[model samples]
Target: MKIQLLPSTFDENGTASRRQHLSCFVVDDRVAIDAGSLAMATTTAQKKQIRDVVLTHAHLDHIAGLPLFIDDLFAGLDAPVRVYCSAEVLETLERDIFNWEIYPRFSELKNKNGASVMQYQPFEAGREFTVKHLRIKSISVNHKVPTVGFIVSDAKTTIALTGDTAEMSDFWQTVNAETNLSALLIECAFPNELEELAENSHHLTPRNLQKELAKFNRKECAIYVVNIKPMYRDEVVKQIEELQIENLQILEVGQVYEW
Candidate 1:
């Protein structure tokens, strides 16, 4: 499996600024984790192969482009695209995002042949499930909303992605326990100067994130950081550098990573 950061704040030089958020990973080139940037970031050929989406939560920044993503590929799909998430997240999507007033409910909305474009598949919080060729588990994390971080493994390569969290222990514990973790995509959203806002919003600053990482027990694998606020990016970068974590690397969107 190959993972690529899509339209994050530090997206590489060529990607457009207006439609930036998050997305695009290749699980045999078929599964997408979050659809926020997939609509605009991917080519038509790539969209046609996206058979499943494992959403972390329903926040606009995480799931905003999902509706348009479905619409763009509705007619192009051979079968329904499976959407996996917690039961609570499904309810939030129904009530807030896909409700008729906001956008056409893709679960009920159909394509040219009257088959639905999207299908909601509820997943358990700590349970493991298979999507395509990988084994995946959701680890609950502290966020403003009901959110989950994901761990995906193809046996040899175990990768953990903390969707958005602050001072999480359980997820890091699980990561440390896993024997073959190749990479970790953790988050550092605000600079230490914005510590108050980061705390209020359930996000992490460099200092707090340092403590959170301390819980990981060991720095055995490559660590890639994501989700910095655009306005305070430089400050966050400086602070993260000051932390002096040896194996850490900041994720640049549009860069393809193989592990």
Candidate 2:
């Protein structure tokens, strides 16, 4: 499996920066895990190939690019873009985002080909579903709103991703049961100094992240940290590095990682 966290911002030199202001991950360039940067950062090829978007939650940073993505491809779509998410997320999207007052409800619109422009495929938490060649299982995680982390498996690779979360136990319990898990893409969103803010926001700091990692039984599995707030990126990275965990590393933005 190949996964790349899409870059959400550019540097002064017009280069993709390491700082992540939004959240989106493209898997094998075919399926999108989130639509945060789906419209802004995808390659021409990726935009054409990725018709399936699996959402982790309905937060603005997570779903900001979704409507734009659908609108951009509205005229040419032969089939609807299939969005896989939980029913709660689906409800949020319809009530908050796709309401006519906010954005055109693509779910109710048809393309030139007379097919719906977008479709929702709601999945229950803890149930495994297939998207293209990958099998995915959504596990509810601790977040400010209703959210989930995922365990994604292709033919040869199986990996876990915590979309945006704080301290979690059920996630680790489910992940530890996966015998063939190769990697874990976890989130540490704030610096240790902001522990109170992190807790109130339901996000993780480096200090608590270490505690969460202790629940994992697989000591050898590669761990990649993600979703650090852009302004606090350096401090969070420095703090995580100070932990001196051999297998842990920060996942680079826009870099494709394969396992």
Q: List the residue pairs that clash in candidate 2.
A: none
lDDT of 2 by residue, 23-86 (tens): 9999999999999999999999999999999999999999999999999999999999999999
TM agreement with the true structure for every prediction: 0.93, 0.99
Q: What lDDT would each prediction earn against the true structure?
A: 0.81, 0.95
Instruction: Report the number of the highest-TM-score candidate.
Output: 2
Candidate 1 local lDDT, 16-69, one digit each (tens): 442225644445567788877767776565677887889888877778767888
* Model 2 lDDT-worst window of ten: 104-113
Off by over 4 Å in 2: none
Compared with the true structure, the alpha-carbon lDDT of candidate 2 equals 0.95
lDDT of 1: 0.81
